[model samples]
Target: MSTNFCETATRVLDIEAKAITGLKTYINQDFNDACQLFFNTRGRVIVSGMGKSGHIGNKIAATLASTGTPAFFVHPGEASHGDLGMITQSDVVLALSNSGETEEILKLLPVLKRLGIAIIAMTGNPDSTLAKLADIHLCARVEQEACPLGLAPTASTTAALALGDAIAVALLEARGFSADDFALSHPGGSLGRRLLLRISDVMHDGSQIPLVDEQATISAALLEISRKGLGMTGVLNAQGQLAGIFTDGDLRRILDQRIDIHQTLIVSVMTRNCVTIRAEMLAAEALKIMEQKKINALMVVNAEKVPVGALNMHDLLRAGVL
Candidate 1:
């Protein structure tokens, strides 16, 4: 790598660190008040900025939206050209600018004020017009830019991004937002699959479930396991209650005892205290139980302790819960 490239990277890191440290003082009541305003707003948060600030604003909007807060990004330049219609009195505007004096953002302030929209200004200069005009001001000031020329927005942008995150997280906690709620917003993602997928959704039911009577011979149980392809069979008593479980591991133990599979009753050789999970339980929760017990499969039982379904590690793997 070039020496100049390494030097530039170091400068970037230094400025970003300074920017984060400078944000300590900015985390006071004003930040909380700003969060309250967004949380209470009936309409969406309209984040607006220009250039790099705009990019950061987009991400902040998305984070807020995915975390149970309604939000969307708007371009200040576009707002001036009639997109201001997107802003309403019930909505809150979060304006981002390093100097707090971007002309394009300033142009929309009048319309925003006329509509009675609340403004939360994120700026490096608290004394700037945007700061003075806003209902709440979040100071994203930095000691210096990372740029060698001292004109770029490196430090200031980092401060703004961190402040945005702080607001989103605070609101998330205040609203009692949870991982399950986040998964709802990201249903197509891996997190959603883990939290939303249930054992009933991945478990084998009906004829696919490996089952055998307690009176069944070990050979018969083995045939059921082979036919069901789960490497295990649920042993049910004559009263249709869960008696025990016969798995490949149980067979290994039985063989070690020199038991004859063709003659031994499945219940006599099966594993007692078999681990079982309910069909209504989340697949992720079931996976944790399986892992903690160091097992690979679980029989899904109903309220009466009857085996209604079955699942194994392969089921979790195929469902993306692994």
Candidate 2:
């Protein structure tokens, strides 16, 4: 590592930290009005800027869209060519510029005004022309740039990014958004599978469920376990209700006692008060319960206490719920 590398890294950290801390002064009525404008807008939020500000605007637009607000990015350079048509009077535009004077963005202001679209300006200078002309102004001023040359966008851009996140989270809370709603927007990811996957979708049903009558011998239960390949079997009484469950652990206990597998009835030796879950429950919830109870297997029962399905640790593992 070079000596200058460590000093540059420290300067970057100090400047960014100060920028975030300085945001407290800017988080006032103007910020609230920006959120309100986005909340009430009938059309999508069209974010635009130039250079580094444009990059920040793109990220802000993405965060808003994923967090329940409808928004997308538009390049200011493109807006002059033909993309300005994308903005409508019903929509709200959020424009970013650290100097409040990016030429490319200034070129579109007259057209935006002509369309009667509301504009929110995010800039460091409140007195600049862009801020004066906007419906709302969000201050993203940083005390200094992190670059030793003090010319790069480093600290100011970081402040803008954090402000964008703050706005998204505030809207999310105001709308009472939940994890399931978030998963819906991110359906292609693992989070969606964890939140939406159900026990019935992962549990073994029908012939895969090991079952035996109360009168069945331990030898018969063992055969059912082997045939079903679940390392366990549900013991049912004459009424067809679940009586107990006999698992591989029980087999070990019986073997130590020298119980005759041929003569012992499963009902007499099977485990009572077994843990179970319903087929309709979330697979993630079942995983939590299994961990809390220190057990690896569970029976799926219906309202009638009839064994409808079964699952073990391996099932959850294969389902990616582990």
Instruction: Note the Cα lDDT for every prediction shown.
Output: 0.90, 0.90
Q: How far off is residue 97 in model 1, in Å? A: 1.3
Colliding residue pairs in candidate 2? none
TM-score between candidate 1 and the true structure = 0.86
Candidate 1 residue lDDT tens string, 1-322 = 4478887798799879988987998889998899989989999999999999999999999999998899999999988988988888889999998888899999999888888999999999999999999999999988888886888777778888888898899899999998788878988877889989988999999889899999999999999999999989999988887888988887777777888889888888888888899998899989999899998899999999999999999999999998
Task: Report the Cα lDDT for candidate 2.
Answer: 0.90
Candidate 1 residue-wise lDDT at 154: 78
The residue-by-residue lDDT of candidate 2 on 192-294, one tens digit each, is 7788888999999998999999999999999999999888999898888888899998898888898889998998999998888999988888898889987
For candidate 1, which ten residues in a row score worst on lDDT? 1-10
Give each model's clash number: 0, 0
